[model samples]
Target: GGGVAAVLSFGVANRLFTEPRERGRTIGTMGAVVGIVSGGGALLGGALTDLIGWQAALALPGLSALAAVRVLRIAPATQPRAERLDARGAVLCLALAAALAVLLQARTTHLKESLVLVLAVLAVALAAATVWHVRRVPEGFLPRLVVSNSRFVLAAVAGFTLFAGYLIIQFAAPRLILMDHDLSVTQIGLILLPTGVVSAILSRTAGGLAHKVGPLRLVTALTVLSAAGLLLAALAGRQPVALVIAVAACVSGFSAGQVALMAAVPHLVDSSVHGVAAGVFQLVFITGGSLGSAAVGGMVGAMSLSTAIGVLAVVPLVGMVAAVASALMVKRQTQAPAPAAGPTARPAVGAE
Candidate 1:
């Protein structure tokens, strides 16, 4: 639960640092650290699990709690407000998400036909209810200001698809290597270890690159890189080198794209709703990742794993359109006609 709760803090990244470049740099450094640590952990996890047991592979994340304790000193203070919780809207939103989750899992879980029917009905009902609630209360559980923004949508979609691709690679690579190679668990991890190295290097530079290339192009390029990785895995993944390259491309794109794009959220949305925007983006990230893995797991039984991955590539590709649109939107926003105000009035940055 602590691990899950930890995701909630992701929104704080935007809140912590105000400067765009600084935010980018910090997020990139974070990506680097995570990549390096994860790479080492992957190599070690295999050896440790074989030697000590699976429990050894799982004990390390607990250390993050200690890091959190020290971090509290720098955490932002709470701003008390008297607005009541939108319990009805919250319940509706949760039900809607739950319904969608059930549908995504249905294929993998292979629920009974009757159960599927019930779930389908529940999903429709929940969807309608949630939509009605949102319309009735635009500023309720899901704020209009947050959800309606194109940039926020891109952030959500980018995180969603990038993570989907990330999860797909994670599931596909190890399985591919184990099927063809007679390598030890540790050896397989070693083969996959370079993904982390590649990811770390790219992550470290992503911020500066995004600043240079602009968010739209950078995100599209990364998405293309990710899709190419998936395509390689589908077409030539039997070769260990191909799989390694595939995973590297996929992970590097995910790591760099996530940090760079998220850092740009402040430029797109109002400061008051940064938290909401971040929360929505991360929620979509988690959902899309789950759905991505679920898509692979559900389809691999009926289709080739490679084909499933090729199909999965569409997730990021669709997100690329959103990313491009987001960039265009940013351009449009920046180019808005200056207010025809008196000389005494300063220009205000519009936060739609």
Candidate 2:
């Protein structure tokens, strides 16, 4: 949860430090750094666990927290309105979310406990009260305008689909590699490396494409490609040659779509609301990720490998549908003329 909070904080950071060209490089660097640390730490930690004992893994996270503190101290802070941090609303939300988290965990653990059931009901009520509070409270944590925007709603849905597909692939691929094809962990990592490297290289190009072609067209193309790639991956399953090609396409399409979507966001809505809109989209994305992990894992356990792959492909297919809908809406919006202002502000008559 704390890790998720840190990642969420970076969304505001991204919007704060907005230079089109530079933003891409910044995200890429941050992504690369995270990838190296996560991957390298796992590799070293595992070795240390085997040789030096189990406590070595604990040091990695401890060190990471210390590093985060140092970085936060040095990092520039951009003060959005202090009012944006609604204390009462935050407390209610945290309580509700924590309850749900506990209840979800309970299903797999001590299910006989009445406390879990009680907490679940309490969470639902608290969430309802939170919504009511948002409506009535002046200077609350959530802004009414943020929730009311149609574009934000659509963007949130799209973000959910994008991350759902990503999480599904991440969970499924390793299983397909290890159980079906008998590949070692090192080999699985090696196979996955190419996709991440390619994404890092192509992210800048994707951002440029978003600007030049307009986000709708670029995103639509990428989303379609993503759907196709997932479908292909479903078929490839355990076949190494086919799996590699399919995974490459999936990674490229997903990365490109993400870049285009992020670029489109500021253009799709008011700049003042960018931080809130982005945060909502991110929240949905994280929710979808959790759902995807559970859903995919469940399907894989219940059905055969082929069936699991088929189920996983459905997420990207939904994304393709959303992409088409968004493109059409954008086109319609573009074709509409801007409303004229006050009578005196109207375009000059016969001036040209």
Candidate 3:
């Protein structure tokens, strides 16, 4: 359900803004809201569980969703159009995703080595088949033109790698704090609370900065900052103050980078395919997070947590390189002559 919301929200965001600068600001504002909610969620959940029960805590999202429905009803609607649903592509993608999840889970479970290998092979095969089939189908589930754009491809890579690093911190930091310091859940939440606050404040500023500095450069710089945060986490040991500072840095960088990446998406693809492109971009983002969590979990099971974190620090550095490449790609594309309009080229529905 969260995944569905993410895809739909991104699609809506893409259609709602055409000017890159405005889009950046809008996305940054949205990121601020997300940071506030996510930052407070842990503390709220702990309090609710303590006061009432776990069931009440679990119902919070449903209540939020109900409130969202009220807002959505009053929102302006886009023109509806019909397109053929690519059933084969959909099935293949679903199968591929499931196989990959199972493969990842297997690494942390007591599954036999042979079974893990089989799941890995199945996932790879499904992925290859999905790509092959999508390329052959005109107007397939995925937008071919958007996928083919060098700028979009690099942006997707940048999103994936940076998000993986962020997820690693999210998954590891709480565990490290509890294990090393023997802190209560409430205490842990308090220690990490500053992260969300810093993220919310930075997110709003990041959009304007992206508008001035360019999305690629902003993303690259934020990613480098995220890498530095991860390095700090690796060396933080049991120091509470160091951990708080490190986590705040990670959260701020991650939030800013995410907004910049989202702002760049619409410019990289034709306006007509905004919804599909956003969905695909989000899918990549979620996939990276899942992979990061799985990789870190598996590593922790095999070695010391600090050692695992230190190793995973390389992920954000990779994202930094990808961001640089994306900047170059966008520059090259902009300098090149404009190509003839294809089937996907249409005026954006909600350009202001």
By lDDT, who's the top model here? 1
CA shift of 209, model 1, Å: 1.0
* Candidate 2 runs further than 4 Å off: 1-9, 12-16, 28-63, 66-70, 80-84, 87-134, 137-142, 344-352
Query: Taking the tens digit of each residue's C-alpha lDDT, what string does model 2 give over 1-352?
Result: 5436544555745765688667655654554443343334334555666667778756666666666676677566766764455778868866765666556446444556678768878988998998898788743655667665555556556656666666666667667766566654556666666656555555557766777888657766655665665666687757766665565556555555556666776756678766666565556666666665656665654576557656677676676667667666766777999986876785578866
List per-prediction Cα lDDT, in the order shown: 0.78, 0.62, 0.77
Which 10-residue window of candidate 1 scores lowest in summed lDDT?
1-10
> Sorted on TM-score, highest at the top, how do the candidates line up?
3, 1, 2
Clashing pairs in 1: none
> lDDT at 80 for candidate 1?
85
Task: Provide the clash count, candidate 1.
Answer: 0
By TM-score, is 1 or 3 better?
A: 3
Q: How does model 3 fare in lDDT?
A: 0.77
The collision pairs in model 3 are none
Off by over 4 Å in 1: 1-6, 84-98, 137-141, 339-352
Residue pairs with colliding backbones in model 2 are: none
TM-score of each: 0.88, 0.76, 0.89
Tell me the tens digit of each residue's lDDT in model 1 across 1-352: 5324435556566668777777788778877876675556668889988899889879967777898897787877768868778899868766766676676667668888899899899989988887787777877877878877777787578767887897888888878777777887788888888778988999899888878887667878888888889999988887989998998888887778767666666777998886776666666766676777777887887788889998888888987888888888888889999868797976568844
